[model samples]
Target: MELDPKALALFKEGYDKIIEGIKTLGFDVTDENFADTAARAAKGLHELIHDQTQVRKDVDALLAKTFPAKYTEMVISKHNTCFGVCPHHLLPVIYRISMAYIPTEKVLGLSKLSRLARLIARGPRLQEDLTHELADLLHVNLASQGSAVYIEGLHMCMAARGVGAHEARLVTSGVRGVFLELATREEFIKLVVAPPTTLV
Candidate 1:
């Protein structure tokens, strides 16, 4: 997808300002090795926070590819690894997401579940918000009987700074419809925390 040239230019300007800020701390931004640093940083940051409108478009396209379900059963996709930037500290967050839904008539392609998680996580967002958004999308877009999203996030803001609690992980969940039931919620949580099956 083509990025907006104007936005790219603005991002470069922002990065340039950051480099100047670093200079105040006695970091030499003018060294030969740092010539293209601002440009590269700008480009990388832009990609990390890809255009949200385009992301939503991609998500809609994926959801459009659903197939009719022969039976109504719980569908679960686990360990969908995703990356995002923390809005507060601008640090990276690593996410392991698990999703479950009981289909009403149609169901998403299995791989689409993982793709959906990654797409939604491509920008700066809070873990709590991401969890709720994922559940809302599955429940509403697929017209599912119920949907649930569970996420475990390792935030760099927590690990690399503050109290430096490197082992800290944040867990969050969102549920809708029948997933709001106590038994159904417990089942989802149990499966999420269960050990992976041995590969044959």
Candidate 2:
């Protein structure tokens, strides 16, 4: 498989550490038994750090390339689904993200909004952090008058194993700019929480 040189190097270093640890624990770890270990370790490390670094640059580039227009209306994208493991439990949290931003002089491409959601959802994450991070990206990227993001998720930490509050879905939100400045926050919240058909 193709590999990042840096990641490959780190994978080798990590592989030695893992082998040492397993041997120290008195396990009969060997090259054959541990061959896939380095690959998986590298993969986990890559996914965790990719967004923490290069992905942020991608977001920054998109923001810089955006051209502004006079569309100062609440831009809402809803029901975008997300699936991932929780940082705490490594259990899954499946959810939908809803985003809205009133453009000031700039508007991001519609699909980038979803791309942002995907980036923020990478690796294990807390649903709360996931919600706020997406909103923060939108708020910062658009430099908008208002931005709001809300997430509704069913966490495996709660369902699929635990007390089985199968009906229990968590709600998390982040509001910024005019979303936090004016009555827009309430309006956006109401609209997002309101009936679907009410929006044209």
Candidate 3:
């Protein structure tokens, strides 16, 4: 479904059409608050259509730097903030992501791990995909002995559009390697949901 020349020609016109459509429903497009809504919506939709492609990771240099060295340590990147819209309803989904992997021979710079999460998450996405992708890459790309990713999000899709029920939360996670095994998974869950009390 490529955009033909005819459609491309009407791109700006289409934006005006949306403004008019909203106006017809008794909304004021001329208001300052609505100044950039159309452009923002356009960008969000554009991102949704391009979900399959991302800034791919090149691991050659990093692998050369860290792999074949057999270093296993729990590398955790926590409290990475994410802002994205849901593909289904274009609703806002915001969350904090905590990702950890027990690296085996290869380790990424902590910032790079956060970069990977943001790369996969920028476009329109599902909570399930967001969480699982972080875990999957940490497991597969780094060849981690264990990997875990947890996401806690408030999805406006269900609250504002679907049934207008607010305050609903969506949590999704993915585990691989030792994180997939029994005892490790249990510990990970405990840490995610109920961290042990520590005196600071």
Predicted structure with the largest lDDT when compared to the true one: 1
**By lDDT, highest first, what's the ranking?**
1, 2, 3
Model 1 TM-score relative to the real fold = 0.92
lDDT of 1: 0.90
| Model 3 segments more than 4 A misplaced | 1-15, 30-37, 40-54, 57-71, 161-164, 194-200
**What are the TM-scores, per candidate, against the unseen true structure?**
0.92, 0.70, 0.74
lDDT of 3 by residue, 1-200 (tens): 13234333344456768898989999978899888666655554454333332244333333344445355756777767777778887667777777888977777776876666655666567889888877877888777787999887877777666564577778788999988787877777676665434658
Candidate with the greatest TM-score versus the true structure = 1
Model 3's alpha-carbon lDDT is 0.69
Candidate 1 lDDT tens digits, 1-200: 45767778898998889888999999877788889887888777776677888898999999999899998989999988898888998788999999999999999999999999998987789999999999999999999999999999999999998585899999999999999999999999999878667779
C-alpha-based local distance difference test score of model 2: 0.75
Per-candidate local distance difference test: 0.90, 0.75, 0.69
Q: Which ten residues in a row have the lowest lDDT in candidate 3?
A: 50-59
How many residue pairs clash (N, CA or C atoms closer than 3 angstroms) in each of the candidate models, in the order given?
0, 0, 0
Model 2 earns a TM-score of: 0.70
Where in model 2 is the C-alpha error above 4 Å?
1-51, 194-200
lDDT of 2 by residue, 1-200 (tens): 13367766776687778778988998877757776776776675555434456667766776676667666889988877767678777666777888998887888888878777766776677888888878777777667776899888888788876675977989999988888865887877777776456346
The stretch of ten residues in a row with the least summed lDDT in candidate 1 is 1-10
